[model samples]
Target: MSITDKNLGSKAIQWQAHQNSNSEVPENTMAAMNYAWNLGGIPEIDIRQTADGIIIGIHDATPKRTLSVPEADQDKLISELTFDQIQQWDAGVKFGEQFRNEKVPSLKQILAGLSEHSDRQLYLDFKQVDLEALAALIQEYGVARQIIFAHNNHENCKTVKRLVPEVRTMLWIPARFPETAVETFTHIRQTGFDSLNMVQLHLPDAEEKQSWRYKLQKTFIQEALQYLGEAGMELEVLPYKFDQEDLFELLDMGIRRYAVDEPSVFVELLNRYFN
Candidate 1:
């Protein structure tokens, strides 16, 4: 199958409910994943291994900020904590005053809950764990085809390829990178990545800086279109917030994939524009 056929399915909406202030949704919780799945959007979650070798759904290494772990005693690495000790801390209580009662979730529980929706896609962001385990888990669930591994670490991407060659992988770019699209693409190709994932804000830099943004504006959506046309690489643009004009411009430029936090707004935009 073609790369796009393997990577792109329906228009994707990423529910970062783990960071939501009002939802009281714990990061990587079954409740959070279920909420995203129920919204008829794709569920994206961050994964990290606890000290005990159990893969749990958390974004940070320490439980201090998001859990009830004492500040003085929160120095334990995730890889060193057992699941039972990890579960003892309340992740929800520290999730701002709004969501003061959320619970931490295990990756297995989330996957088991998500297994019912065979058609939906999942974007797994590995924070601090071996990609091999993630590959094994995906393979175990027979959902390798429906998941995408995104990471900034090239080694992790390589590891994923070593473990699951058929699984799609994207190189994630931080907002501060100072490379042009050509330079970026060249780097990605050198790293043996299948695609590029970038924030929408990164596209608008001056020529002195990375000119991806200027290029997109000058050619409209044709900038990325031309990139894909020339290099045959998939593009996944992540927009921080829903901006109708920006979304329209991206759609006009031939970008079919987007990463968004608000599914309801994205679905509305999709229905009005693409549907």
Candidate 2:
């Protein structure tokens, strides 16, 4: 499909801000996400639960990378601390002086801000946490329809489905799926997830990079998509960094949605290509 208005789907394929679209800053923050969204990108929060069980937008097993912390605490998981402790973290100073006052936001807080914008869409990368609390917030804000829940576990995805029946959910397709194309489709169907998110198969490794092995792998992806398309399933792929050629290959395979960290770059390419 072309990256046309039609192919891009109901809304433009906005860039999912990876970690608030800023690396040094703790992601899932209002500042970082808003910064990107204001610049015409979509916010994708990687959320996790704290030791005290509060839901917040966070990625990584520890707080070091995003939060300013001593090297000793670098490996400490967010689960080791309470929500209050997490909020006290230097969530933004490392990123820049402008964001120094920014603090980690609770899920409810983020939802509250988003409630104001009718066009705002959030793609949440769930870290297999319980969705009951999150579901309640979405309901309270009346934005259940604006969220897309993405998770790697079948049960977790099922939980999202059960808690927020109206929300769309994507199940992660493991690196090693069933042996054959038919088997892959069967596996996905069995999970009963509404959609899927998978790793992009086009990357380095010269021998298999663009040769016979690479072509064969791409063939399998195409076959799987064919079955999924016929069965009314949708696949979204995200590569850490996808070059122009990578975009064309994925497009040739009928792939549409892309969850890229640098969404503006890709979106610009898509616009240029489609126009």
Best by lDDT: 2
The CA lDDT at 119 in model 2 is: 79
The RMSD of every model to the true structure, in order and in angstroms, is 5.5, 4.1
Tens digits of lDDT, candidate 1, 1-275: 01121124653434322233323245565556766667665566788887667788777777666678867659777777788887877766564555555567777776675566677667777788766777788777777777777776666766786788766676655444434544555565565444333312234334463423333344533554455556655566655544676676666665766666665566677666644
- Can you write out model 2's per-residue Cα lDDT over 1-275, one digit (the tens) per residue? 22354454553443456563445334667876786667566677888888888888887778877787778778888888788887877777777777786788888788888888877778787873567878887898998887888765656767777887777776645433224433544666666434343322322222334422232256667765666666666666555446777776677666766666665577677776667
| Candidate 2 wrongly placed segments (more than 4 Å) | 1-15, 20-26, 71-73, 96-98, 174-185, 190-208, 211-216
Output the lDDT of residue 135, model 2. 84
Over the full model, what C-alpha lDDT does candidate 1 score relative to the true structure? 0.60
